[model samples]
Target: MVWPPSLRQLEFGDGFTVRIATLKGPPSLQQLWIGHWCDEHIARVGWPMSLQQVFFSGNFDQPIAGVAWPTSLRVLSFGEKFNQPIAEVMWPASLQQLSFGGSFNWPITGVVWPVSLEELSFGDGFNQPIAGVVWPASLRQLSFGNRFNSPIARVMWPVYLQELSFGDAFNQSIAEVVWPASLRQLSLGRWYDQPISGSIFGVVWPASLRQLSFWCRFDQAVAEVVWPASLRHLSFGVCFNQPITTVAWPASLQQLSFGDRFHQPIAE
Candidate 1:
């Protein structure tokens, strides 16, 4: 039920928990309270006051549109209905995991990820990926668009990136990617690219990389592709038009799956 007053602070037991029954205008308290109510449920929540995770979702009109601010918050996600100018919002410095899955008309231009940010996800709507967004030093997992040709070649990934997943747009040339030595798990595949280049740079495969999947359509032969020695789990799809002749299996590779025809197999 909607709160009768626009500014009413519902105090819960101690801190770490709160339920705004009906906030009329703004919180009269100085600690943590709503300051303004401009066509917004709570344009911004989680001031320096007390609150761990804040979730704001409504059809209010504001710059933030729908956002929550928790100084110590580790995860921050914008609702799919959020279409306002989110670029104006300053992400919390304590954020570790962030997901932008909203189908908004705006693109996340030049926003630096906080040093605390570790995992980041971008929905399909993020058009024209940023050429260079510094990944957080602590970042490990990154999942973004996978269909068509999403420009990931230029984005400056964190040196510590480990688990990376592409949605469907996997048409990137391996040559364009500068894999970090700290990388562990790399997953790339899908109906995304019609013709992928097999000659893409062959990563020596970091010793950290344990789980890896190479699936997708390639105009060339699979034999041209080189598998990293550290890869443990590998999955290959009908990405290669021609058959693969030699399949170099890494000693660490324990699980392998070859879907459909891959030209020639490990030379029998």
Candidate 2:
């Protein structure tokens, strides 16, 4: 079916399959969202020149050829079941953000990422170690899902990164890891129930840090940890039972949120 030339966005829900190669439309289209489809179906499609974002929530089990990608695409998100290795796929130079959903277990250590990429995210089942991965220098934000338990301590983080997050299975101590000086926000991995005794204190947090969040299973007392003077926001997860007042609050703190187990009274 021929869509209106003025259409800018197209979205197809589950169980719906549309042959984009057969569809007729103008180059005004910017976003394309589709359900399960094979690489041949995507390769055959004539993508609009103006398309910037492509989101696929289908079963992409086959490898995607470089010709299947649109040069104008800036953001690309794969489905939960897409397990194809992206090493063979030629990422567009314009890409800024890339995400891998569930079931994507390919190792990205040797894969070349687009230099323009600023944000990178991983979903469940991505357990491959990224220690030797050559990360894009332009990266600013990074996140991982529950099953990602890679040892990031050996990875050389981009100096420009501002936000860093980890998955539930990542219980490795980050106290000795050299964090970037540009980091502003940090989110610890969930399911981390270990005591934070003096581990956090051993690391030198960047002065640029503004936000810090604890994982859901963190129930340790952080009173011994020295909070950064540049911190503005702090949050605790569900199982954290430590009293909020026991820790020395930073003078720059403007927002504080505690978990359900914290019943301490605010002295303000």
Candidate 3:
């Protein structure tokens, strides 16, 4: 097919195979989504230098150690069926945002993430332990999959991380985890019912924290929790019926929500 020189984006339907040596796409193509189930050798489809975003949303599960990823690629993603190991694949230097699909449960401890990465998110099936994984210094936002309940006490969080979110099954003790000083937003999982008493963790949260959210089943008391002075938003989960009369609400708080179960009297 003769692709138009002015064509900028292209997404192939499923069941396509790369029998040609090169895709011969237009020079103006900046984004490409390949959805072929049988194409194992992705490097055979020569990527244009102008391509900035690439997505693999098919059954391409072959090891990609020898694939020559494009230099200008800034965003890359895979679909829910992609479960290949990427520990040996050299990632693009300029890649910023990367997301794994639902079925990617491969071990990623040895994978060297891009140095310029800003946002990285794992899919629901990724529950790999990451104690040895060194996240990039430039990462600002990071999130785990729904089944990820790995211990993060020994993991070194990035210094500039701004937003961090855990999945629904993560109910591990966070008393020993030292959150990043630059963290501005934090969200705990739905099943996180652990005690975050100030006596146990002690002024642990960074002063830069602006938003905090507890999950649906979190019914812990906040009277002993140390609310950050810079906190602007706080949310307690649905099952919380804890008394707030003695709780010290932060002076900087602008938005406060005691989930559906907060019907206790203010003077209680």
TM-score of each: 0.71, 0.87, 0.93
CA lDDT, candidate 1, residue 176: 63
The Cα local distance difference test for each model comes to 0.57, 0.80, 0.85
List, residue by residue over 1-268, the lDDT tens digit for candidate 1. Answer: 3323342243322232223423332322222222122234454443533333443332223465344564666655554455566555677787787776445446556555678888887666555555566567899888765432456657676888888887665566555666777888877746543323344454344567788766665334445545667778877666544555464567888997775665454555
lDDT of 3 at 75: 95
Pick the winner on TM-score between candidates 1 and 3: 3
Off by over 4 Å in 2: 1-3, 18-25, 36-41, 194-201, 243-246, 263-268
Candidate 3 per-residue C-alpha lDDT over 192-241 given as tens digits, one digit per residue, 9 for 90 to 100:
88777766654378889999999898887778888889999998889888
The better candidate by lDDT, 1 or 2, is 2
Residue ranges of candidate 1 with Cα displaced over 4 Å: 1-41, 44-48, 56-62, 65-68, 146-148, 192-207, 216-220, 238-242, 261-268
lDDT of 2 by residue, 1-268 (tens): 6678798998876766555567554689899877775333565677888889988885755566545677889999988778877776788889999998888898788788889999999987888888888888899999988887756657788889999988888777666677888999999888766555584435567788999988688887676777789999999888877655677889999998877777765563
**Each candidate: RMSD:** 7.0, 2.9, 1.9
What are the per-model numbers of colliding residue pairs? 22, 1, 0
